[model samples]
Target: MTEPRTETVTLNGRPFFLRHWGNERLPKLLLLHGFPEFGGAWADLAPLLAHRFHCIAPDQRGYGQSWAPEAVSDYATPKLVSDMAALIGDAPFAVLGHDWGAAVAYGLAISRPDLVSRLIIMNGVHPVPFQRALAAGGAQAEASQYIHYLRAEGSEQKLARDGFAKLLAMFSANMDTGWLSGATRDAYVAAWSGPGRLRGMVNWYRASPLVVPKAGGSIKMPDLPLEKLQVRCPHLLIWGADDRALLPEATAGLEEFAADLTRVEIPGTDHWLHHQKPQEVARAILDWFPDR
Candidate 1:
């Protein structure tokens, strides 16, 4: 496989790192990664799509070599979405996001519809439905208990201790980690080892407005304006059915918000499906936008 070209672009007055695959002349595809991972998270999937699209993966605000702000408010969803907006400028492009990256993708699509031609989410959820599930204190809330843990003060230090054993455990819990060994594992460790990176990454949880209630407990749902949360572009959701962290409930009612939504389930995989089954994930993405 060919290596991705690395570059830096200033966004929000801070230098942000990016990894590019394929030529810039092709249709642009922005790939957003999730927690405990950076733009390099697309290493397995972007190359497969490079044949037809210029895949650009950013390390996001707090991951990899990108700007890592110390304030928790800096990781807010709107701020995160704006960073991507700055990167893309005036042209609209296709966007794909996994895990926490999906939150920014959804925000971009909703807040700046003209910036996203198409939206793709892998093992991620829309905020409205996800927040509902989380507030209900059901399966999804139980699964998302880690969010609170991550938001706790000094939690990043704890996760980084003992060679990141706690972080690794949290990442691999009830998921397939066979793909996370050798060099891949070392790379993740290195990213986490960056000064203040872990705190910056966890701040995303602290800054989130979603409320995750305790199991068997329910909280009043926030009044989310549906009009402001609509995904106007074509949307594709590729789910890893076996994911334990994000239950199906998290994605329920997604169609109500997405104008044109298509869902495809890839069984026998979990949260790391992109890593464990990149070909299938790529195929689903390519198939969704055949005419592009």
Candidate 2:
């Protein structure tokens, strides 16, 4: 694989950091990183896919070197989805997302399917099922309790202090993080330390309206038509079965939103499945979408 070029693009006058690999002439492949992660999280997967497509991963909204506005409104779903739409442009590109990035991808696919050629989700939930899981309180609500903490005032300082101790603790709480070396730790520390970056990232939680019910509490879903939110495109969901944060249950009833939904469950991994099994993850993607 060729060495990736680091570049920046202006979206709605806000600058976004990007890492590009492969030939730009090839069909585009856009990758989005999840919470507590930056575009560089695709370091391993991008290179593998670059040979087949022009792979570019952007530091979305409030992460890494992207524009990190302090207002919660800036991180709202519409704004976040627009950021992706701007990056995708007029051409249809395959979009891959994980965690919070997945939420953004789902929004884009549902609201503006023209920009998305296909959708690949890894441990990311669709709105209806995810909101259902959050409202139907149980394991998912218990797992997502941290969302409340992130929404709390002053949570930014707690996560940033001691070199992002609390943020790193969140990663450790769920899955195996034995792969994080001193150097990797240093890079994450740098990304999280960006000016107003921590506050901007946390605002994603603050701006979201999805309510996670408390223990023994049951919540209700909105009375909207599934077709309104259904992903009207080829969709592939690659799940990390052992994910403690976004449990597998969130995927229940997902077929109702994706008519052509395809699922591949890779056992024994958690939320950070790409880092743990990049090759297998890439292979799953290749099997589903092929080289196009």
* Strongest candidate by TM-score: 1
Error of 2 at 17 (Å): 0.7
lDDT of each: 0.92, 0.87
Instruction: Write model 1 residue lDDT over 236-257, tens digit each, in one string.
Output: 9999999999999999999899
Error of 2 at 240 (Å): 0.7
* lDDT of candidate model 2 versus the reference: 0.87
Flag regions of model 1 displaced more than 4 Å: none
Cα lDDT of model 1 overall? 0.92
lDDT per residue, candidate 2, 1-292, as tens digits? 3457998989889999999988999888889898888988887688888778899899989999999998899889999999989888898899999999999999999998999989999999998898888887898888898888889999999987777788899978958888676777778888988899889889989999788776667678656566689899999999889888988789999998999899998877888888888889988988887544
In model 2, what lDDT does residue 9 have?
Answer: 86
